[model samples]
Target: MPSGGDRHARDLIWGRKSDALRDLNRRRVLRAIMVSPGTQVNLAKFTNLSQATVSGIVQELQRENLVVVDGNDNERGKKVSLSNVRGVAIGVEVSYDTVTVAARRVDGDVDRVVVDWSGRGAEHGSQAWMRECVQLIGEVVRRTGLDETDIVAIGLGIPAAVDPRTSTISQVAWALDWERGMDPGARLQEHFPGVPVIMDNEANFAAYGEYLYGAGRGTETMLFVKSSTSVSAGLIIRGLIYRGRHGLASEIGHLVMDPLGVVCQCGNRGCLETAVGGARLVEQVRGAYVGYRVDLPNSLANIVERAKSGDLLCRRVLQDAGRNIGIALSRTCNLLNPEKVFIGGELGRAVELVIEPAIQTMRLHSLGGMFNYVAPMTVEASELGLKAGAQGALAYALTVHHIRPN
Candidate 1:
């Protein structure tokens, strides 16, 4: 009973839907190219679509001026880089007491890198900190000679767990005492409306940071331990960070070392952090120096310095902490069998004073032969150190590209 006009309207609706689907498929194809530039044929295999479909999308993307393809010239095996030219990408790492940002040029060969830093904490209740972030970003963009419209996407890493379902923070009490109900992603989205704000846990980003530019370069699987105000770890397997169920995979600080031990901020007793975190280390050492107005370094840096000067007190304390860390690491190693274990954050440089005891304890408790070849598993100090979080933010944003396999 349909009239000609009704049939025409239905045809129009179907045409719009077809275009939308094509655009979606084109975006996916482009993502694959951006992820690994030289990759080919694999995108179709992974997408479970026909190679012809992928190729057609690629052609459409290229025609739209969003992607460019270059030939391998004489090399038959060399695949083209499905280059994207829409905009640059930015990454930000907002921590308890600091904000770090990084940016990179998206399209061209003139690689530009910008680093932004501010001492604004989550406790600042969003406004002051958001202002600082805006100022920093604006300053960096101007410094790099790119306009606001030139930024395509932004990624952020935070310490608190972000609920995957709600895209809201799961619990902020343990990490940020003041801003318990803030949604950092929403705040970021407010600033850069229209751009997607991708958020992740700090350890996940740190693991990727190490894998991309630091101690974990070329590692098949890596364990990155962050020892600072708190102790946490991240896992990188096959060169990708493992985000556990609910995006809270690497919560290593809460692995109970002693049920009767000191309570953690997470309401757990005797967590690894309760024993080896910066606050506890400083507290333990402060009682030794009474009236001298002793000021401890943010990390155990001063302790490492004192230990290097042959101070048995500092050495003993650090060694004890190392033993505790190793005890936790041994269990983790048994479970994951990682090829490398990297130490970062404030306490990373103290590996020399700590690694021996950690190694001894790890050997004592682990299952046989799992870690025998883990020799030179290289318990390395982070070259990136405290900057890892910030630097990782930038590199992550720039590198996550969408592409099509040709």
Candidate 2:
């Protein structure tokens, strides 16, 4: 027969082990709801748990105020959603010519505002630009019917590499004029007191946003490239952003293509960006039509519009840029072997003109053995499009809001 102390010790250890398993099951149920709200039946299917087990876990979560049951008490009809999530989240993306702010309840639809700052002195490091961001965020909050006090977190996405250790933008991020150690997140926090702010590279957030809610959904691994005024890439491995040490992992735009070609802002020659960035494409078109054409595109958007309207020069330039971007992406694909590739930003809007050529070029450069070993990778335009960065920021804020300690 066991002694009293031995029995007590056995009971305590078993009880704790049981509690840990239950906690893990509860987290699985909660995550399924966060991905997309569904009835208990649907959650059971999504999580691969028995229906009875899912129901019990859902009930426990509801009692703890972690989930809300929408609709009637009917088990088949009621939908489960996250409840009492504390507060809403805001995502802001700042570009050279635009600022986009999106606000949403932690478990609801998003409301957004896009403000064009082209030629209006909205340059980075300018106080006016920061003020404009604050104003637009206020407008988005109003649209969402949420007060500033209800903002729990704000996510800022910039077109620059952020040092994870120091939280500073890199000097080579020429698109931004922000000084070292200048925290954009901190600046936004001043407007919404008590709310914490998170920041990351714009492409990184865009990739995360797409992974969670757009084309990259259901993919185990994916790479997202943004080819707009500049070129950048982001990697999503198993639904999480893979920011390498120092957050410089996916600086594909700076990858050198030619040692003696055009000089890049990063002090490199013939970087991928120099060959395929929107400005360079525009330059090529402008120079080609210098004396021949009466109508010239003033911007990359204009060129895309012209290409859609059957301008051969515009079409060729976009195709050429696509090919170059594809060649660069091929090397990355060989290394990471992503299941899907998503293209976003301005040029991504012209899928018919750009994506096909990109796919062709990538196939040409990729390893034949790799292609034979796995399923042929799919390439698609980003479903979030220009809103990817802002939406990603919002999703990131909501995801981290509950985990951060006060």
Question: Which number leads on lDDT?
Answer: 2
Residues forming the 10-long window of minimal summed lDDT in candidate 1: 1-10
Every model: Cα RMSD to truth: 8.8, 9.4
Q: Which lDDT value does model 1 have at 55? A: 69
Give a tens-digit lDDT track for model 1, residues 187-231.
777777655566766766777777765767778899888887677
Query: lDDT tens digits, residues 103-171, model 2?
Result: 665455332333223232225455766787888877776665555656656788877777766556754
TM-score of each: 0.76, 0.81
Clashing pairs in 2: none
